[model samples]
Target: MEVDEEENNDSISEEEEDSDREPNPKHCFITNLPDQLLLLILSFLPILDAINTSFLSTRWRYLWTLTTNLDFDQRLIVSPTEDFSKSRRLFASFVDRALLLHEGSEINRLRIWFNYDHELYESHLSSWIRFAILRNVKELDLQLEREWEDNDFYFWDMPFLFNPSVFIRDSVRVLKLCLPGLDPTPDMRFGSITTLHLKQIGLTERTIPDLLNFCPHLENLVLDHVGLYMAPLKIYSVKLKTLSIVNSIQMNGSVEIDAPNLLSFTCIRYLADDYLIKDVSSLVEAVIIFSLSNAFFQNWRKIVNALTHVRSLKVQSWWWMQHLQQTGEYSEEILPHKFRYLELETVLSKMELPGIARILRISPNLETMVLESDMVDQMVYMADNNASEESYTGDYLEKVFTGSPLYLKKLKITSFLATDNEIELVKYLLKYGVALEKIILVPYKTGLVSVSPEHLAERFQELQAFPRSSKDAEILLL
Candidate 1:
């Protein structure tokens, strides 16, 4: 009996030992991943978020140190109640610490946005830039906004801590500078930079040449709200494909572009003596906007003549009718002849129809056209008053509708009031435009006034069904 009891006790002890063993974890907990995979994951995160991930675990504590792209945004750090001075100090310290932590890494890009407290942060900015150069950063974007209180004064004259020449190097491929009305005299040896953007900068004749000379390999150039103090600077870029200049008022100088590979060009509020874009056979699209002035007529002619080969064109001449009326020669001489698509936004009048006709004459193959009238109420009222005078009404409508090139298949008219005269205009389109396939009329619906979609669709059908030669035409309403 004693031997049997001992055997049972031994069996129970073995079972208990087996039950105490724990199951092995299916996946191993790896504290470190391949550096390439870490970078791939970090690339998907915003710079700030990536930096904050350092606190997640000890493994991630210095993961940001391996990141080559650093972006510091003061707007994200500054609170409305925070002291600006303290915020600037903290920003400087954080940048310093991040750079020190990532000392050995190859920094590829650094983007910073901060309020331009020149007196306080100028030296710190210089240090940060030096650090970026030491680490061989390829892309650098610095956007500086001055406080509202400094608006009335000249903030551009603030003493710069670093010479602009020091920042120009072969390692940098993209550089963007947003300064407070300062003309930067960058070194010409920074030919490695492929993209350049300058905002609210003053580019004098000498300064413009200096910049072009420096960025010889630049592929994309953007100048926004920049002033040209001298005659338009001559620009010659063999590698440049995209160029955009916006809200630039100083026009005494003309921009002479000789980029052979240029693909796209956009210019707004650029008043220059001779606007020239030559040998850009690769040009595919262009947008030229001019403020209504007599000087613009010359520039417009120059631009239209250069961009005649463009397939798509957008011409926005705000208040141009008033200027044309005042000048007495209400005709646009330089109109594109080969544009497949055209979008015009301006007030239309009888005097301007000839210009429109001229455009259609040149672009005989135009497939689509959009006409947007600025003053719908006035146009409708005028059409109503002259409804009885068929000659007056017919002539006006003929000038507006037939002026379009004969091949226009799609016509979109927006902001039209359904007054009798406007309706007559629509009728003239239905009667005259032989190749018109689709006509979309969108009535001006604002405030408490509204047009029923059903009513509009019905009226459109009635207009299309009005006794016509062909049954292929369709009218749409919105």
Candidate 2:
């Protein structure tokens, strides 16, 4: 009995000893991951986040140094209380340090954003450009936000300008600059840049021609809120494929876009249209945004005339119908054209359906139609005030849908206030939409109580019981 008891005691001691032994290290195989796989994983992380991973373990400390893409954003480093000058200096030092730590390594991309004082801006700009050129950088994006004083004070001595023509190296293939104001000096050149984006820059006729001359091999160009000083500005680019211009003010100067190889074009609030629409056979898509002004309407017509071969057309405007009515060009004159997709927004019920119908008539091949607005209450109120005018419910829907082309397969109504008339409109579409594939109803704040899919299904079934011919329609409520 004593021997058996001793044996049991020995077994328990051995079990406890085994339990006390440590398991294999959790990340024993992490170090074995291939360097290429690790680098690829780190590439997706933002530069700061990737740097922070260095402290996770000793192996990760030097791993970040191997990353070829370095992105430094000063907004991340600046605090409200930090002196702007000191903050700029510290940021510059950090960037220099990071570069030194990764010396002799090739950098794929470099992005820096800073708001600097006038004294530091030029030197820091030179350093960044020099570093990018030395590393044979493929992409360089520098955004300099000028610090503004109180509402009355000016921001800087000179509107912080960096002439890409003079500062950029031939090795850079992609370059983006967003400055408050820039006057490209005559000596500036960007001969080797393939892609370029200029934002909020003052580009006159002479300056634009000079800039274009520098980028002989440029392919893609984006100009946003850029001022054109030259009237009748003629742009001639042979290698350019894509052109995007947004919120640009025209100098009553005619602007021409003459890129033969240009495949895609987008213009928003650009006044002059001389260059784009003139015999652009290769254009596949054209998007135009107009303001509710007489000048824009005249330009809109010219733009429409220019887009003879456009496969996709999107027009967005506030109070478009009122503008058209004010111009006295009714829907019967405009609704015979064809487009693949159509999106229109207006103050609902205030605009005439015939005018909407006129716009729709032009898009015979339109497969999808999206009607968005926040004016249901205004429509209801207007109908109440003018009882003689038809309500914007069943009558309006019947008129528009009945006249609309059957090619429209999808209809999306967003930010809609569902009223009795509006529900009847949806039912009418479901009943008459013979080629319709889907109908989506999105509720806004007002209108009928909560909506659901079951309610939509029941409504659809009730409409079908009366035997309208739209056999394959699907109704969705959200």
Candidate 3:
């Protein structure tokens, strides 16, 4: 009877154990997905992650092979346990294997970005380029950053070249090549590309003009750090809407542009040179930050007059000539007088005040104004004259106030030393500007003028109480 009871108890225990175990579901949601959808899902992932999905299940084994877009960026790899050398080797091996096993006949886009290595990865990189070109990639973005611990250019003598002629497919729309190697055939052309971005490209005289002659559909062009062996480079494009030249050195000749449909023009990190834009009446914005040269002095007025149609403008001059010659004294209607926003940065000496006054006087429609500069001459002028701040500004401020229509809605001054001259100028603007909305004073910490915070508070009170044309104008002492 005890043996019978033990068998019955064991049977009950087995039944409870069987009930506790849950049955596994037959279908996984991801594996059940359509092949096209799965392939698309794999395309969004990095190649490494895409390949790793093969380990998930049989359905995802070869899903990555159908991926038409390949973007290999080494910077994406991050692992705390693994060192970079190991990660780099694994990254290279995976990309190499994936491309070798890729099933797509044509690539939609192929982008590769990595620091250039000459000894080890040169052939690998070249093979990858050839693979993409052979597969008829429509968009190719190849950016090779030259890793340099010292100052010399690492790629100045490397022989592994990137010839744009390899891109023969008419389906190509956008092509960006960094450190683009040179030597082009006379008749070679990119018939379908609409956007071309070239960086660190050593361009000869015939290269740009010849290239632009064939690329008529190209509307946007950016030349950054381009080593232009030819001076006075002529960039003539009818369809170009946006053109920017930055950190590019041109030795002798002045740049001449004739883009009729251009809507924006920007030149920065370059010294002032003659940039003649004739037919850009549609331009709405312009940014000019140029180093000053003697040639710039002669062409300053012409350059300003050319960009007259732009409504927004920003200008900074590192060097200013004490005496300037006017090639042609243009009337207010002819100059760029339609500026709604203007920012000027300079060394605010007494002499540079006229330049500020000149822009203020001409821009009758200007609504916002920003001024930033170190005040040198204004302080010296007051010290040398031994006159009060009000007396010193009585001449310069009154001239600008009377000569120019006072419609400014906002004003900002940087390096606000709270000196008598500076205060007098602010007072003059507050008193004259009838439609002024706001005035900002950024008290620069030059330590040259020592005004206590209490004194600043008193000045703020005085400015708030000291009446002017615009009663609603607020002052911010920041």
Candidate 4:
């Protein structure tokens, strides 16, 4: 006499149920799905909406709680009427409750991103970190942005002191912390950390030792806008394969790298007194970008000499090229004479011809050259207000123009404006490169903005008509 509960729940009277319900025939297709597949479908939905699935039927009542990933993004919770403070508290409460009831015993990944909050949400944030630690979370990402007010003053809603001891479980292999004011303890360690990223943090005397001891297996490291408080910063890691150091402020500390296995290194706008690079024989690629006027030639030379084994190099030294002229620091003898691929970012000007020619001369076996003018910087060039024309010295035409290049074959010129100076540079390379095989000219406005058909045609026509020494050479225009 008792109706089956499962059948009773599935059966709704046609008169009582809304017409919006799924077609009657298709009802059980979803409810009959396996639990594992159902959990995955819930994982893609927001936590709030995922939890609402329990209302569908008895089968999905606790399925959402079994999700191994937790992503709490504030943008999903904010309402038009709520202020920043109210929104912060509401998000905090929702997250705390979700974690407390979350059925997963071993969380695989946890991510939290929220709008800047003030003093009210610190404890909640701390609890979240503790929860991740207790659950042995594998991947954790915490992004805390600063909240700026009318006065342009901002406050970072983050715990300045993060004791690495809490994360000593060594379960976290990949971690990214982007807090502007994070300060670490000297004895902190991330035992199993392999890939680590720290942004807008302070590096003091204890910074290097604290990290090296804690993260022994660290291989990939990226430090961006790190404030250096010490004089000499020494980084020695034998297992490190990749490193990136970028600066938002002038670096007060000189860095010395002793990573023997390092394969790639990138430095941008970093000012150090002197760098001591040793045993980095595994290095194959390097990118160095500097505003030459603000850099010391001697300091720049020391950095270049260390890259003796690099096969691929890209340098952005627009202002530095002019610095060589103004400071009389020109040198054709410093760098090694071995390079397979060399890409340079500079404008084609008479003043830069000597430095460029000197560079080409050193690479006796250079095969490919890429010249990009989109990276042109006129900072130092525009500052030379008292400059009088020197009648365009540095006869690239008579010297590099007439000489026979042994290995130079392929050339690609991007952001080409078809200027007289640029054309002259092409002519110089064409006449000298007896082995030249191909030429590609991409107009300055190629992909950046719209270019008139006439202008684009002119850029291609000018370069194609330029004479080449190799009779079998082919030219392509883009």
lDDT of 4: 0.68
Residues 1-478, candidate 1, lDDT per residue (tens digit)?
A: 1112233233223233433333334312433567677776776665556755554444555566677778878766445456777666666666666566564456788888887676677787888888888888899888886664655433434455445766766899998888775555644467698889987676766775677777778889998877665556677877889999898745456678888898888887776677777788888888887765545676676777788688887785333343444553334444666778887764445434444544555567688878776554434544654522232234543544554425567878777555454465456656656676887877877754576667666666668668643356687776
Name the candidate, 1 or 4, with the larger lDDT value. Answer: 4
* Best candidate, TM-score: 2
Residue 204 displacement (Å), model 2 = 1.8
Question: Taking the tens digit of each residue's C-alpha lDDT, what string does model 3 give over 288-347?
Answer: 765444455446556667887788887752232223123222246434788898887655
lDDT of each: 0.66, 0.63, 0.66, 0.68
How do the residues 1-478 of candidate 4 rate in per-residue lDDT, one tens digit apiece? 1222332233322232332344344557987889888878877776766765665655656677898778877667545367766667666766777787787777777888776453666677778888998888888878765564565322222346444455566789878777665656644678788887876666766676568777889998888766665456778999899888876333466778899999988887676777778778899888776655544666666777788788878775454455565656545446645777878777666656656666776787778888877332543444464333342365533554455464578888887766676777777777677788887888766454555768767756776787777886777777
Top-lDDT structure, candidate number: 4
Error of 4 at 195 (Å): 1.5
- Cα displacement (Å) at residue 25, model 3: 20
Model 3 residue 278 lDDT score: 66
Backbone collisions counted per model: 5, 15, 2, 1
Query: Hey, what RMSD does candidate 3 come out at?
Result: 12.1
Q: Candidate 2 lDDT, tens digit per residue, 30-71?
A: 656897777777777766666655544556656777877777
Q: Residue 64, candidate 3: how far off, in angstroms?
A: 9.0
Q: In model 4, what lDDT does residue 196 have?
A: 79
Taking all chains together, each candidate's TM-score versus the true structure is: 0.71, 0.77, 0.67, 0.76
Could you give me the TM-score of model 3 versus the true structure? 0.67
